[model samples]
Target: MQIATMTIDEIRVGIREQKFTAQEVVKALFQRIKKVEPEIGGYITLCEEDALQQAIIVDEKIKAGEKLGKLAGVPVAVKDNICTDGIRTTCASKMLEDFIPPYDATVVKKLKAEDAIIIGKTNMDEFAMGSSNENSAFKIVKNPWDTKRVPGGSSGGSAAVVAAGMAPLSLGSDTGGSIRQPAAFCGVVGLKPTYGLVSRFGLIAFASSLDQIGPLTRTVKDCALSLEVLQGNDPMDGTSVKEVKTKSYLDGLEEGVKGYKIGIPKGFLQKGLNEEIAKAIEDSIEKFKELGAIVEEIDLPITDAELSAYYIISSAEASSNLARFDGVRYGYRTEDFQKLDELMEKTRTEAFGGEVKRRIMLGTYALSSGYYDAYYNKAQKLREKIRQQYQEIFKTYDLIITPTTPSLPFLCGEKVNDPMEMYLGDIYTININLAKLPALSMPCGFSKEGLPIGIQLIGGEYTEDKILKAAFALEEELKLSTIIPEGKEEI
Candidate 1:
């Protein structure tokens, strides 16, 4: 059987029925990685021995007639930024090239407890800074849809692995639009849960307030299943909310979108959006309407300021969070320097990529004595205003709809020179982070060039189930069959 082509649910059934052993699935994934990693560059490190060992244990448990967790035996790729005990967690930056955490991140712990096998650590942009994955200190992750185009930033590796059929499910951290943007580029589903909804205990800090850990999968149902395992609060993380009961995400996968109110934010589909992407989103809305959803046009007054505030706030927090990587305690260390100051300067300069350095400088400048109130303080106030705007809109709407990205995946090196233009690609997604709302992006259609386009569904805080239900409804109404990457055979 072609294990790589199967969904997470299908794999679980295969294991339960003894149609395929977990070891065989893990072996197939490794073989797939060996074949595709050269072109995709999805992983920074592959934990072959560890993953296979765990899979064997799962196979034994299944043979012993022991009941398993929801994700038992499912192989998942983890983003490099999330700490994995005993594995190097570099965040795709040279500064932490040799750093290995002594403990797993909270999400990693949860996945392990559920018997999910960690396949490997995936590549990402340095310190989660760039819009495209090209900023990684290691290598860029290419979009599975078109090898010449880029997979979106930070979570690019995680998204590409699932899209390319190298892994069934993966974990990705979304600060700004990392998870959703890459999912859009790779033609997969990515969920960025509400702030504090998932524990962040050992996720290497990017933009602390904006970052939330979620899943990247081929289907919305797989994302929901992964979230179920990773969603509870952690005592180790103060920002994590207390345990909240969540609905069975898989229970309503086939439920149609009857009596649901989907809001279309008019400002989201204005000028600058590509005609093809706009049409795709409009078609998706029509499909939702046909599925018994009530579509309404709404306005978010602070949409314009969202990107600006996101940059200001994120950069400032990143600068502060990154201060600990000075070579004295952890991460990459320089042996050539004599003095402490020289060592610190040399290590950072050589270790960090240009984008990471740029943000650090921008953030340091923003938080400086005279500029704090002008940039950081003002951005915080605007963030509150944006959150308030979302709160008001959610009162009348169940979910907000938008084109996940303004344009299809661009050719490699196309916008690498222009950081501002690259940042603008996330216009539709960054606001959800700013407002602390939950959002999901799913493949909706293809462009004229055969590249994939995505449609986003944004929901109120803690309304992830409602959001996924809407996505599932649209998925059926549109009948969007999964598309494999060109030139690849389904294993």
Candidate 2:
């Protein structure tokens, strides 16, 4: 039946009708993984036994006539950064490659409660540092659409799994476009809910203030379905907001886009963006207009400073969050160290990838005594300014639209040498984290070379519903279902 090709909605319907058991679905997924994973490198750890056990339990519950959650019996891929109890939580770094948590992360707990079978832990850029999956201590995750190109990162593995139909849904963490950028490159839907909207207790720290966990899925409705299970507050996480009662995210899928005002930031489309990307975004904006959305040009001057502030603030927080991985508590340990300092240095140097080390050094330098105020402190102030700018823009517009990335997916190893250039590629996305807003990335068009182009829909804080509705409308209008890479026969 090609169960992997089914969307979450189709799977849910199929499960209700007893067309297939959860165990069968999971077994099919593992078979697909065994067939494709070696070439794509999407997963780091595959829990075949545990996954089958959970699937069996879900199947039993259905047979017993027990109520099931929206995600019941569905298989979803999890980004390695999000902790799953008893599963090795390696944020694609050698440091925690063998560290297993004693408890589930907030999201994992919620998914389990919903009877979702977690299939495996996917690969990622080490500690969510780089935009390409090449930085992963594990193998690089290639784009399912074009193996020669990257899938984007550090959520590349999650995005690849969905694009390749290995999983209909997956979880990804975005500190600075970790979710959206990859979704864009892989031609899938990736959403980053507002800061504090989803609990972060189980998500390994990257940039504390900017990091968020959200879904990467085949469709906007699938993303919404996953969000229904993952959203809400956990007392364990101080940043989590109180649970909010809302209608089903899928209820509004057919709602037309009348009376909606979508703001297009002129600054985003201008300067530094590739010609094809700019045209693609404009074409998408026109599609929204055709769908009855009132498109207007808006200005967001603070976007120019987004990348700078993101790097400074994110690096500072990373330096702090990563300090615990010094070979003492968890993760890799050095056997030949004569002193504590030697042990710490050797372990860190050996365990961390180059990009992780670069960010740590940048973070340490930003937080150092004399430079703190100039770099870290100033960056904070700039963050507030960006937030204020977004707030003001949202007051007049229901959502702001822009290109998810300035260009299509670059070939693997294309931008690896120049760190700064690679960072610049995330220009349109990093600011949303700084502004603490909700945003989604969805496929808008395909480049001439066949690479996917994504358009981002940014909304005010806690405006996930609005963003999803807009994305859903666009998805219907575009009718852009992604195609699996042609080289999978060789995999």
Candidate 3:
């Protein structure tokens, strides 16, 4: 059997039963990566030696009769934006191309504690700025379903790697649909936990308030298993939720969505949506009804304002958070400037990519002397209103369903030059981040060209388990969860 095709739970059981050594599992995946990575381009850095060494240690521990962590011997990849000490954590940007963290991110620490083998760091849009993987300064990640199409970003690599069977699971950071959108494009499962549900300490920040770390996996169960390991309070992150969760994400996952009240936003289905996708979402809602869910049509009028508010707020935060990289600290430095100010300007100009520069400029303008209140402050108020709207809806509905993305994966260069079109890719997803709620994307069907299409499920704050359970029920009903991209062998 190909270990790369196994789910996290299956891998855990196999390792415990001595069906295969951890070393064998890691090696098999690495071989798979070597074969498909040339076309997929899912990974930016591969930790071959370190991963194999860790596998050996895991095998030794098993032989010594020691207890293993939940994900022991499971091979996984991490988005390059999350810090991994001594490993190059380039956010697919030239600025941090040579930068290596001295300490692991909090989530990475938790992953190690669970003994999940880190096989590599996956590619992503530069600084997690753009919606298309084409924005990565290093290389663009290709959708595994069709190599010519772009994988959704900024967590594109994480999704592609999982879908390509290069890794059964991977960690991805979602600032604005980065995790879920890519999962939709690649036809996998990605969960963007309620803001602060997963600690942000050591995740290279794009937009502090909006950024969240989540998991991308082939199945909802694997996604939930990873989330259980990922969630919890971290003293390192002040924004992390302090209240301890009472239950495991995997618990009651098989429970059907009976008696649950689900809402379908009338606004999400309107304009600019693909007919095929609209039909799929409508079919999914009907399936939920068949499963005994009380489905209703709800109106969230503030949906139109989400894109503008998201851009302003996220950009403002990105400007402040990125100021730390101004040549004086770490990351890329400029040799052309003799003056300090010139050095800062030159370094940023040379190191940062076009999209990064555009965002920084927009953010700086929004936060500048006269524009702060007009732009940034106004955006903040609008964000609160948007949050309240969702809060009100959730009071009556247990979950809200929408299309994960408005359209299927586009051709690689089709929208790379058109920033507005690229920004529109996250239209259905950005507002959830603004509301600080939990949401997920799971493949609902394939397109005419066989590319994957996803349906999204949103839940109230800290209701990750509820959303996962609902997704699990619907996933079972649909029976279309296990998908391997065209070229990948089932083995």
Candidate 4:
């Protein structure tokens, strides 16, 4: 049945119709992973034994003629940063290399409640620090489209595994473009819901205020389905928004964007846009117009300062959140240290990666007494400006459209040494995170080099449904559903 190529809906139906047992589906995908994972480096830890056992239980439920959960028998990949009980949840960092959580993240519990089996924990940048996957202490995730190229950062492994068809759906945390950037690079659907929409209780924090857990999937419908399971409040997360309408995200997904107002930020394409990507964005705009959407050019003049503000605010939060990972607690401890102070200093110094340390220092310095207002406070004020700008725009536009990334996936090691170059890769995506708005990145076109190009559809806070509907319309029009990597045939 080519289980690897099946969508979440297809798999759910197949299982219900007794076309394939959940166990058989997991087994088939495990076999596919075995063949492609070496090349893709998508997973940090595969939960083979655990996933198979869960699959057996799901099959038994189906055999008993019992009603299965909404996502029955689906195999999913979770980014390593999200906590999972009894499974190694390394944030691709040396400090937590051997860390296993005592409890599952809220989303993990929710997925399990819906009968989804977590196949594995995917690799990510160390503590979700870098724009490229090179920051991982374990391994680099290669773009399935071109192994020599990066799969994008932080959530790179989640995107890569889905692109390789190793898992039908995967979870990724977007602190600042982590999910969307990787999804764009890998040519899949990545949706970052409004910050407070999904509970983040058990996600290992990168930047608590900016970090959000979302899904990366092969299709927009699958993305919405995962969101249905992922959204809602948890008493565990104080920041969770309980006022959101808790309904199925896929209820009216097939409704095309007939009377929607979509705006393209003029500042996004003002400069530094690749010629090819610019053309792709224009083409996508015309397609949306043809689909009966009201497309227009709008001004988001604050785009220039979003990246800087994001770095300051996010790093400041990161420094605070990561402070808990000292040697006294359960991560990695220094083998040699005499005093408590020495031990803490040495543990963090040795356990953390270069990027982590760099951010920590940057954050600490920003928050230091002498520089607080100049850096962190100023950044916070600028953040408000960015948010208010989006708020004003969303009042006029139903969705904001732009290129997902400034360029195609760069070759591995191309910009790893040049931090600025790597950071600039997220130019188009960071602002949405700062504003805590929902946005989705989907495949729009391919670069001349055969690499994928993505177009992002941004929504107002809690407007994920509208964004999904628009993305679905464009996804249908593009007809790029069958665009798999060249090597999937063998798997």
Candidate 5:
């Protein structure tokens, strides 16, 4: 079997049964990465030496007939924003260019506990700031499907690595549509779990309240598998859900959406949504209906306000959270500065990318004394209404469905100059984040140009199992094959 293309189940079973040594699998994946990485630019840092060493231990464990973890020998890529001890956790920005973390993020610790090899740290939009992956200070990550087009940000590298078959699984942080949008653009499965479902202990904070760490995988089952390992409360993270009533997401995953009440927002298919994406959602509704689900259009009490609110709230949190990056502590510092204030100013000015600076400014402005109530406070109020609206919908329906993105992946430079237009790409997704709900995005169909279109399933807080079930059922129904891209020497 192609080692890089194997699913999580296949790799675990294959490793357990010794179809191939874990060391061999790791080596083969490196071979694949070496071949494609120049073209795809998915990874910012690869742990081939460390990964090979870890793989040998898994192989030795299997030889001794020792019990293995769920992710034994599986090579999982990590987004750069998540800390990995001793590895430089650069958020694709110069600020943290050579800053090595002294401790692993909680999720990274979990991955190691399960024997999942840390294949590499994937590139992403700097500080997880932009909607398109082009905002990285290191290099722009191109979509694996079409190199000329963008992979969605800021988890674009996570999605691209999986799509290119460089890694079977990758973790992405979703603040707004970071995880799901990139997954949709790359035709992979990406999830944004209910807020606090996964520990955010080591994630480089972007928008703390809205940020969530989730997995991007080739299949819905894989997403569920990743979540099982990634979830649970952490003392280090006050936000990690402490009393969540958990269930097996994989148990009834394939049982289909029969007898389920699925809600579609009435008039949600506005002119802003792409024609092809709209058609795909309509088709998905029919598929859900055919699968014995009760699909109906329901009126949702929200609007474009979410787009404004998301930016204001996320930026405000970013302003506060990012304050720790002052030049005195760590990260990139200006070589020349006259005073402490001048040092902070020069370090920040020289190190942060344009997009990062932009958000920081917006956030600082929103939280400033005069504008606090007008921008930040109003955004918080809108956030509460969004949460209330989702709670009301969940009281009556099992799931809420919509197009994951308003449009298909566009050309790289298409919207970069227009920040508002770039922000509009996340209109369908930011609301779910605003409400801190669980949502999954997976392939439903492909556009005529062969770009993948994704359908999103939004569920109430902590209702990931239901969302996964519906996504899995629809995935099995559609039967869309994975399109692993062949890379060129250069973009």
Candidate 6:
């Protein structure tokens, strides 16, 4: 069996059939990581001894004929921003370079409950602030498909691990398009659940109302399986959904899209959309039609408003959330400081990266006394309008389909200097976050250069089931299943 290419289901069944031992799987995993990590830079930290010990315990349990949890012996990678007890969680920033949390994030705790072995904390943009991994104070994540290209940001490291066959699943937080954009670039499945579906108790905040923790995986089914373990209410997080259901996310995942209604935004294919992406989306729409689903073009008149509102609201919240990093509590503190003011100023000025500083300044200005109503308050009103428009559409359509990105994965430095151009890369994705809706991005087609293109499916709040069913249908119909980058060394 090819351990590197195995899916979550395949690995579980393989272990049950005695095809491989859990220890052997971890050993081979470390061997693969040692060989490729230099080129891939997928993880910011590695936990070889702990992961192996967890595997050994699993093997011993199997020997004793004991019942195992859902994710028994499975290896998983976590994004650095999610807290892990006794392990450093840097958020790819110098401010928290050596900071270690005393407790695990709720998502990490849930993974442990299911018997998943966390390999390590993956890299990310500093403070989850950029659309490309370039903002990372540590290193940029190279795309697995082409080394010169970028793995899309904030969650770039989380997405890169799954694409490089380093891990079968990973967790990433999405504020704007962080999770979906990277997943699209890396040719994997990424899901952003409803805002309150998962707990965020231990997540270091970027934007409180907008940030959501979700999964990145090789297949749509794997995405659903991970969600099953990750989704639940937590008393620790007041925003977590209170009314919980025990229904399996995998129950109707394969039911197919026989009579579903899917909508295509009229503005999604406008100018600036790459020709290849446009063709791929058009092809995907026809495939959905052939599968017996009704597809239509609809207008989301507040589309532009959503983009404008997202920046204002997200920045305003980020300015407030990131203020706790002052020199008093923890993290980095500058040595060149006399009094309190100098210490705070020098600490923030020295530790924060250029992108993070830019956002802080922008957010501070938006929330300033004179401009509060002009910028932040108006943006909140626009947000309500955007949410209502999406509700109006979901009343008629079961899902909204569009290209996951406007362009293919570009060369590493292509848009680093052009901030506006970088933000436009998320045009198709940010609207879903603005409306607090559930969405998924899955592989749809490949460009002539073998770079992947993805299709986004947006559903009503808490309608992940409908979105997953449509994605599973398209995933099977397209037959672009579980793509691993070419030239990956065989393990």
- lDDT per residue (tens digit) for residues 320-435 in model 4: 99999889969999999899999999999999999999899889989999999998999999989889989999999999998899888889999988877777777788888999
Off by over 4 Å in 1: none
TM-score of each: 0.98, 0.97, 0.98, 0.99, 0.98, 0.98
Enumerate residue pairs that collide in model 5: none
Which residue pairs overlap in candidate 1's backbone?
Answer: none
Q: Could you give candidate 6's per-residue lDDT for residues 433-480 as a string of tens digits?
A: 888999999889999999999889999999998899999999998888
Q: Residue 84 lDDT in model 5?
A: 96
Model 4, runs deviating above 4 Å: none
| lDDT score for residue 325 of model 5 | 82
lDDT, candidate 3, 343-455, per-residue tens = 99999999999999999999999999999998899889999998999999999999999999999999999997888888887888999999999999999988888989999
Worst 10 residues of 3 by lDDT: 482-491
Tens-digit lDDT track of model 5 for 126-191: 999987889999898988889999988999999999988888899999999999999999999999
Candidate 6's C-alpha runs over 4 A off are none
Give the C-alpha lDDT of model 3.
0.91
For residues 1-491, what per-residue lDDT tens digits would candidate 1 score against the true structure?
66556788888878888889899989988888888889999999999999999999999899889878778889989999999999889999988888899999989989998888999999998988877899999899999888999998779999999988899999999999999999998899999999998999999898999999999988877887888888877899898888677557777767777988888877776788999999898889988888899999887642556788899999999999988888888788888999999989988888888999889998999999999999999999999888998899899889998988888999999999998888888788888898899999999999988888988999999999899888887776666536677777654
lDDT of 6: 0.88
| Cand. 2 TM to true fold | 0.97
The per-candidate count of clashes, in order, stands at 0, 0, 0, 0, 0, 0
Which numbered prediction scores highest in lDDT against the true structure? 3
